[model samples]
Target chain A: MLDKTLIGRESESTLVEVERGAIRRLADAVGDANPVHTDEAAARSAGFASLAAPLTFPGVLAQNERFRHSLDLGTRSLLLGEASIEYGRPIVAGDRLTVKTKVADVQERAGTSGATDVLILETEGRGAEGEFVFRTRETYILRRG
Target chain B: MLLARQLYFEAVKVGDELPPLVKPPVDRSQVARFCGATGDYGPLHVDEPFARNAGFPSVLVPGMLAMGFLGELVTDWLRGARVRRFGARFVKIVWPGDVVTVRGRVADRRFEAGGRYAVDIEVWGENQRGELVVRGAVTAQLFYSGDDETRQRGGQPPLVVTPAEEEERLAKLSRSTAPARPAVGTRPAAAPAKVQPAKPAAVPQKGAPPVPVQAKVPPRPEPKPVAKPAPKAPVKKAPAKKAPAPKSVPKKAAPKTKAGKRR
Candidate 1:
C-alpha cells in the first residue's frame, strides 16, 4: 500500500537551464528534422528570438533528482501508466526555470490479476522572471501481490 | 527560407484528419540516444540481458520517446498552432524493430472568452502489429487569419454552435461517402512542401503566447524498410479491439509480480 500521508509532500526546488544541445539531441532522437530546433536564423525567421525547444522538451526537467527523491519510490516495481504536460508558455534555449514537484494523489484499484496502487505526481517549472513555463503530470501503477 | 501556409482557425473543420507520420523501425542506437537525452537510463530500456531476465523478449522503447513522436505529428500538421496541453496513456510496450505510425484528427473547435480559438485533437500511435502503444489527446490554441496583435487581447464574443447545427453536421458527415474530410493516411496531391518556414504572426509578448516556430515535416531515416503497404489495412481495424485490458500491461513488471506471488 502507498503512504497516503505523502500526497501533499513537496520536493526541494531546483534550478534547470534549458540547453540548445539537449533540445537538438531530443529532436534528433525522435527523428524530427525541424531546423528551427537547431538553427537560430530559422527560429528567428519563424518569430522566436533564439532556438525554440520542442513541445515535449520539459520531460527532461522532470528527471531532476530532487523531484524523483520526493516520491520515495525506493526501487519498487512500477510502470508508467500515463503522462501529460500543460504548457504556460513556449520554452526556448537559454531560459532558466525553477522546478518543484509534489505528490498529487494516491488510490487503489482492483484488477483481474490483483489490486494496484495508482500514484499521481505533478511538477511545475517557472521562468527566471517568475512566469509559468510548464507543468507535467505523471501516473504510475504499482502492482501488488 | 520558404514560407509555408499557416493553419488558421478559419480553415480547420470538425472532422479533418492530420497527415500520418510513419516512422522507421525502432533501433537500439536511437533508444540509447533517447536515454542519454532524458537521463532515464533504466536497464529495461538499455540492457538486453536484464530485459530478458525481466520477461521481455528484448529491450523496450521508452514511453516518452513515443510521446515525442506524437508531439511531432501534431506540430508538423498544424503549422503555427501552439499546443496548450499534450498527454498520453501507455497501452503496450514498443519493441525494437517495430515501426510506429502516429495519427490524429480534429475532434472539436471552439472560441474562448479571451478571443482565443482552440481545437481538441485525438491522437494515437500504433506498432506494426496494429497494437496501440500510446493513446492521447491534445488541446491547441490557434489564431484566425489577419488576427493582428490588437485583436488577440479580450474583445470578440464567443462563437457558439447550437446543438441543432452540430447534429445536422454529424448527420451530413455520416451520409457522405468520404465523410466530412478525407480518410487518414491519404496524402493530398497538393500538400505543402515538407521544409517550409513558418509564417510570421502578430504574437503577444506576455501571458499565453502563440506558437513561434514550427517543425519541418519528418524526413525519417529508413535503415531497413519493411513491407510498407501491409500495415494499412490492420490499422483501420485496430480500434475494434480497444479494451487493451491485460495485453497492454508493461512487460517489465511481469517477473516481479510472479516473484511476489511465490512469496
Candidate 2:
C-alpha cells in the first residue's frame, strides 16, 4: 500500500484571481445558457455584483499540480472516483481566492478489477477578505502497483 | 429575483421527483470548448487517435464536465437554490453522440443549524442508450418562504423556478442567442476552433518560478492540420513531409497514448 502518513498533510497554497473572461469561458464550455454567468447586467439583475461563477467554476482552481502531488498521485493511474463541493456563497469575477488542500483520508480496498487505494483530498477556498468561500472533497481511485 | 417563484422548504416532500433535464448531445465542439475554458487538455478528451489508442473508441468526455451538467441540472431545477454540497462519481465514459439525461429525487430534508433548511437529493445521469454515466448526491439549502420564524430570524427566501417561467425565459434567451447547434459529427460551418495551444506549463525548475515571458507568445494554430494526417492510417500520401513535429510532440506530450498502444 502507498504511504498513509501523507494523510492530513497540506500542500502549498495556490492563489487565483477570478477573471470575467474565465467565467464566461467556463459557462460556454459547459454549454450553459445562463446569462448570469456571462453577462454582467444579467448578474446584476440576479442580485450579484458581477457575472457570478457557475457552481462548479471552482473546479478550475482545483486543477493545480501541488494538490495532486500532496497525495503523491501524479504518476498513479488514477480515476476521479467521487467529488463533492460545498459553497458558502456565489463566486464572482475579480474575486481573488486562495486554495489550501490537504490529504484527508486514504484507504485500501479490493474491487472487481483489483486492489486500489482510495485517496480523499479536501480543498478549502477563501476569498481575498479571508472569508471561506467553498470546500471541495475529491476521491481518487489509484490502481495499486 | 431571477426565479419567478420561490421554493420554500415546506413545499418539498422527501419523495418528490424533479423534472428531468435533457442536454444536447455531447459533441466535439463542446468537448473542445470545455478544454479551452478549464485549461484541461488531457489528450484523452481532445485527441481522437490518442483516445482510441487509450482503448476508448473515440474521445471521452471529462468526468468534471458531467459533474458540471449535474450542477446545471440542480440550478435549473431549483432556480436559485444555494448548492451547499454537490458530488458525483463517473460510472462510464461519455462519448461524442450521447444525449445525457439528468434525473433526480428529493432524498431527505431537515432543518439545520442557523435556521437553514437543507434538502438531500439523489441524482443520476444516463446516456441515450440508458446506460448510467454518473451518480451522486447533492445537499442544498432551500429557503423556507412564508415562515414567520425565518422572517423573525432575518431569513429570506431563495429563488425558485416554475416550469412556465423557465420555459418562457429559455425561449426568450434562445431567440436572442445564436441559432441552435447542429448535431454532433455533422460538421457545421461553426465547429469550434481547435483546442487552445498548450500553455507553457508552469513547472518549477530548481525552486525558481519559470519566467512567464515564454508563455505570452501563443503557439501556432497550424499544427492541428498537420497532426491530423499521421494518425488516421488511411490518408497517407507520403509520411516524410508531415512526419516531423506532430510525431515528435505526440511521442513526448502524450506518452500514455503511445504506452497504451504498445501494450
lDDT of 1 by residue, B1-263 (tens): 22334566655776677766777677789899998988877677898986666555778788888898888888777654677888777666777776676767676777665556777777777655445677677888776443432244356543444446546866788787555532322232223223112211111222222110111113224221121111111123233222323333333322211110000
Q: Judging by lDDT against the true structure, name the best candidate.
A: 1
**CAPRI quality level assigned to candidate 1 from its DockQ score:** acceptable
The runs of at least 3 residues in candidate 1 whose Cα sits more than 4 Å from the true structure, single-residue gaps closed, are A143-145, B1-4, B147-263
RMSD of 2: 17.6
Q: What share of the true interface contacts does candidate 2 keep?
A: 0.57
- Point out the worst 10-residue segment of candidate 1 chain B by lDDT: B254-263
Instruction: Compute the lDDT for candidate 2.
Output: 0.61
TM-score of 2: 0.66
lDDT of each: 0.65, 0.61
Estimate, for each residue in B1-263, the C-alpha lDDT of model 2 and write its tens digit: 33334455656666566655667677778899997888767667788886556444667677788888877766655655567777775655566766666656666777655556777776766655444556567777766554422453364443444535535865776788874321211121121122111111111222222121101113324212121111111111111121110111111112122110000
Residue B199 displacement (Å), model 1: 35
Q: What clash pairs does model 1 have?
A: none
